[model samples]
Target: MRGAILPADSDQAVLAGRLDLGEGPTPVLIRGGMVEDVSAAAPTVSDLLERDDPAAVRGRPLFAAAELADRGPLLAPVDLQAIKACGVTFAVSAIERVIEEAARGDMDAAAAVRGRLEARVGAGIRSVVPGTPEAASLKAALVEDGMWSQYLEVAIGPDAEVFTKTAVLASVGWGAEIGVRSDSGWNNPEPEIVLVTNSKGRIAGAALGNDVNLRDFEGRSALLLGKAKDNNASCAIGPFIRLFDDGFTMDDVRAAELDLVIEGPEGYRLDGHSSMVQISRDPEELVRQARSEHHYPDGFALFLGTLFAPVQDRDEPGRGFTHKVGDVVTISTPKLGTLVNRVTTSDRAPAWTFGIGALMRNLAERGLLDIGGGAGDGHD
Candidate 1:
């Protein structure tokens, strides 16, 4: 139930519980490239948006998705090798807050705090150009609903959500679909990257950060600078939420296969269906740990303190600002019914870690991290 707005740097994405679209789900993917302002009728997902957010819609088209089919940008899934060589800007700070705080309970309160933090982070960044209408509106919206946050899912196949895990890693601002789990290891023919695989079935995360950065950057901060969202069109996410449930639960990773096809000027770029990387921690754990680390505040004063921390970096702290662009996103999962989030980033030396302990412990003391544990576990 707990999840952040892809660009955790945008608005606050409170992790709710597991929301099963009843018996079936009508899931469609809209990539960053396809993120166009297309106004499509709502799909059958019933409720995609939040009940409170009247601007919410059951289903709508994405502007990024629109750009992908029509835009031109080098978007690809990266491994730990690539991430290391490139560096990951996806700082698990703000989203981590949402996770930890909500885990304590107070979903509504968590939202308010995270929302303010995201806005603060967005506004703090120096606009490349400075002052233009788009830039100005973007700056204002950064505190409101700027360009850093936006998405829309469409229902593609009838059995769209069949056995998929939609891992929308805001770090990458995209998602992947993990189909099934594998018993053996995958000899990766692909480039260097972090392959999220399942061990037994507990779902642990295996990160192979690149040992060196090939760019002209120094440390994490320099690397983070590379993560800036430039001509980067859009990022896309999966057909459905990859879950380790029944029928689809073959335990063996080979039983699952989620695919994504990218046709650029170079012909067709095929990914997935090939278990090059193994995601140790499945999506569930990703969300679980993400939230587990967030230490909320206690009373009103403490909450206020956490909110106005800097009103600047106080919200997301370290690298969270980069999340506004999210890192490189992907669609498609592996065999184990989970989504593998392929993201990009800068070096790892920067102090991007958000002080969840400092915040959450305070919040937990007051009774956050509850939320009934995300509305989690779908019915039988």
Candidate 2:
């Protein structure tokens, strides 16, 4: 059975319904098109999954998906403490990274990046069990590199990096400015499958997400990826969660198809599609890695990486890159509904100041600086 988590028509309260998809699986209850307020009987989406057993919470009331008032959907699926993003999980991504870096006229750096990608690809085939020959060889090579590394990817935490609103606002107060871009300031939008987990880091459901990134920031320093990605309104997820039970497995999820499309005022800017099977690592592996060092007490959401993102070949001179204001991007799947957002630029841009005091004052003038280092400073 399929459904949607929605905001109540009368008030702004969030709600869910078991959709009437006609002749598929039988839902818990059938009250017209959806099971309105699935939370009435089951509080959270996690609770709904926990009680999904036929013998457990059978005979509950159900409703329809069409009963609600017409309102654009919210992008965020559930309350989350952090949003983690995995990168280079696809071969296409590796190719794109190397090419883009080369375009910046850094052949040596690009070659080193390529070597690391090769190492990662090879390592994935080797067993990393300690004491094994492969493990020892891999460890020695890493040590010999003497701090050299690549953009294997990262998971950006801190609530400030996540956004649900349709428009992405870059702020001047927190160092987000228009003129601060490195290359053309042209940013690209990536469509990916998002996994929603509970406090214990257990997978509960799936959803759509866009991991917005600034190419210019990444082009400058590979180490500055966190800065390139973990900014305000950089991460987006939702439309709603698609739940799964103990019976569901990663293979089952991987079998599903995910697609993305970006449209501007002129027409379609970018389009692509891919499956989880193309990813280098499993979603479970990524989630486990993300939680290895940090604690997400309020639970977390993860962007399982992306596939088939548009790449700028050296031959193609004028490939349109970067998203602009008024651009609309969507990621959709039959299992999880489409997540759409409009691109909007912030009114302010970053400026060069002599000291931290001036920088603080600039933030204060825009009512962006947080007092006592609280929410005022959304720094990661």
Candidate 3:
């Protein structure tokens, strides 16, 4: 998994991430195939990214990057960063969300609704830009035809759908288990590119993410979004964050193509693809919307919503896709490498005991808090 998780051009890539060194979460950098503990320069990933040149920060070498998996489990490459996500940022995802609402969380009924809805509005939604006069006209027409949906409103409406996905220190990293609600009958994984931003909302780096979805809960009522989204071990991010450099820039993120593969314990396999080029809202636009009337003092990780929405029947015809326990889900892109995790019920997944308080106490105990006090400030 370690070999698979590194970028294709890792030797030239500027990477930042975190690892469990038994004492606590330690910020590290993977450069030239070596893992260097950067805690001496910056105590947390959040602090490291606050540097003008986070990739340039040096540290003590711990081990070769090849032994990453054996050294210790990789923690989410973030500390104290808020976890936020955008919804229905792709035409296909918007349509699938409408189907989810129409079916009222019933996977068996989705096929018929999907067919009818796609036939009526798919092309129109795909062509219109959000928050435009053209989008307004489309909304009017859909409402007149008695087909208007809240999901559609957010999809093409003036404001994008940005919501909090989980909390700080709640996200799991590579080779960990991702959770889905046990009772959720309709669900799937959302493969996305997560933008790591600093306190001032500056884009520091990018990483792969799995925004695990519980369609049943959210489809029943959008108000249940919190319950549907925030669950124990439901969010998975990392392997490592590729800090922006001349070698990789926002243009690379704009043209990224993500691939997802789910291997079920019962011999079921599903392959899916999502292209950033197909996204309705540009990554920058989404970030602008997120920063509106908000402040992330510890910075934030924003999930640029996915385009892939699984409609293929897994068990029975017309039943649609849903995760089963022990399914290994892999989300990958060449530049960002890969993020892999096993699926399990929220109740069954390991509890999230380490929170901000635990983190602060641990860092204090290790004398990390004073090592790099305000090291990365007034830079970039």
Per-candidate Cα lDDT values, in order, are: 0.23, 0.49, 0.91
Best by TM-score: 3
Error of 1 at 161 (Å): 27
Model 3, residue 86: C-alpha shift (Å): 0.4
Once superposed on the true structure, which residue ranges of model 2 sit more than 4 Å away at CA?
1-32, 38-63, 67-69, 102-149, 152-184, 246-248, 312-320, 346-380
What value does the lDDT take at residue 312 in candidate 2?
41
Which 10 consecutive positions of candidate 3 have the poorest summed lDDT? 371-380
Highest lDDT among the candidates is held by which one?
A: 3
All-Cα superposition RMSD per candidate = 23.7, 11.7, 2.0
Model 2 residue 66 CA deviation in Å: 2.4
Q: lDDT score of model 2?
A: 0.49
Whose TM-score is higher: candidate 1's or candidate 3's? Answer: 3
Give per-candidate clash totals. Answer: 92, 11, 1
When sorted by lDDT, best at the front, the candidate numbers are: 3, 2, 1
Winner of 1 and 3 under lDDT: 3
Model 1 agreement with the true structure over 83-190: per-residue lDDT tens digits:
111111112222322222332322224445456645554333322222234444544554354323210000111111111111121112123211111211110111
Candidates ranked by TM-score, best first? 3, 2, 1
lDDT of each residue in 34-107, candidate 2, tens digit only:
44433234332333443433124434444344542232333244432356667766656645554445445233
